[model samples]
Target: MGAVMGTALGAVRVVGGRLGLPVDDLAVLKDGSNLLVHLRPAAVVARVGAVTASVRGDVFGHFARADELSRFLAGRGVPVVAPVAAPVREGGWVVALAEHVPHQAERTLDSTTFAALLRELHQELAHFTGDLPARGPLDDIDAVLALLSRPADLVAERDAVAAGWPELPVQALHGDAHPHNVLFTAGGPVWNDFEDAWRGPVGWDVACAADSRLLDRAAVQRAYPAELLDHWIGVRRLLVRCWVAATDRYRAAPPSPSPSP
Candidate 1:
């Protein structure tokens, strides 16, 4: 839970037990259902990071992939810790109960910090491989454009990017790199939520994710070099503006009159 919905310790214990949480010592985070149980006996907390039955859910196959990636990172001695085990949920949904890190890498990130994490996540994305669900930019671009009330140039830009994107160096990207998905801990920035990860160019995450935030594009441009940052900023604005217009279309569209039978 959080400041919004304060959680109860007793309620936590019950959920913990249901998930075979240790009946002994650790403290529950109360928030981040990802770490659902605290193993008092072992001084560890188990994060309910994945649900097998969540095929149509947010973190469906993510449980398995999260574990694999976590392990992969740890083996490389990257600042992240591998949650205890990346096991599949026992029944129905493939729920995963992984180790909960004492602290995440980053939170409430400024431009510098967020950018650094973006670079780190990009590195992790480069290492990922194996059979995983996929979603293409063509589909995403079309869906986003169809719902928007923007100029056709917006859709045309997306189309152009899609066609030319294949020529770029593709890596596994953290499909959605918005603020909430990144965690701040003592280490640095721990990226989470692999639900939308896909083999794509850094621009998919870099150009796309950066623009989604309310960061000042001009300031970012000033901070980074001229040429490199300029291209990214342009792409970022295009992506974020289109998304904004898309979300706005339905909200701003006029309501239709009721049919008179």
Candidate 2:
């Protein structure tokens, strides 16, 4: 698929001459999910390329919807990926671009640096929730319903807890906040994957971050804000457990929502 798209793009470049932008293939990185590429004009102004590409991402939302998020994050002063030139208009398939955030690797999420970044992210998220459509854990429940196991009571639980919790914030959110989704740069940590930005509780996102076994638990607890940590761990057993049932790693047995004969 990568080769096919590259070839077609090359063909277009040949026909359009200078107008046909050359797409530079950025070879596979540590994570094998994206097909990295660079887009540039015919003019020679070497060093920095204006835009970078990641073919697809699980967190990406519809273009217009995503635009709202990208802009919102910028307004809130969060370090999320910056949207590049408007998405190239293509029917059926879509390609989105963002300014390449150059950064060093910090795979370990337990460092004080990481903890500080998380604090910043939560702060920004708190601000982010004030501007968008307010949603609750209930929204996530619907999507993962078919994929979960022993999730029969999840819906009821989400409703009650959400009622007890404060209203969902409307500000721009990373939607899927996870360690890997965050990248470090000279400016600080930048969150990637804006597809899931929506008006939902930090409840689920924070839970996923703190509960990730891949991360150093002590470091997270030591560093995260008291309120943030409280909410994250607060819903871990119920929401996060339900999320696990929805994930591919689990053999989901989401109760059949069927009518009895």
Report the Cα RMSD per candidate: 9.1, 9.2
Q: State model 1's lDDT.
A: 0.51
Runs in model 2 deviating more than 4 A are: 1-20, 24-66, 75-77, 105-112, 125-133, 136-141, 144-172, 225-261
* TM-score on alpha carbons, each prediction: 0.54, 0.56
lDDT of 1 by residue, 128-153 (tens): 67654444344445556654443588
Note the Cα lDDT for every prediction shown.
0.51, 0.49
| Per-residue lDDT over 1-261 for candidate 2, one digit per residue giving the tens place of the 0 to 100 score | 444344434433332233344445332232122223444432211111111112112222344455566666688776667765444333222344556667766654554566667656656666544344345344445445544442657767766657666544444455556677777778767777655555655545555566676576566556653445566565555655555555433222212111211
Clashes of each: 26, 12
For candidate 2, give the lDDT of residue 257. Answer: 16
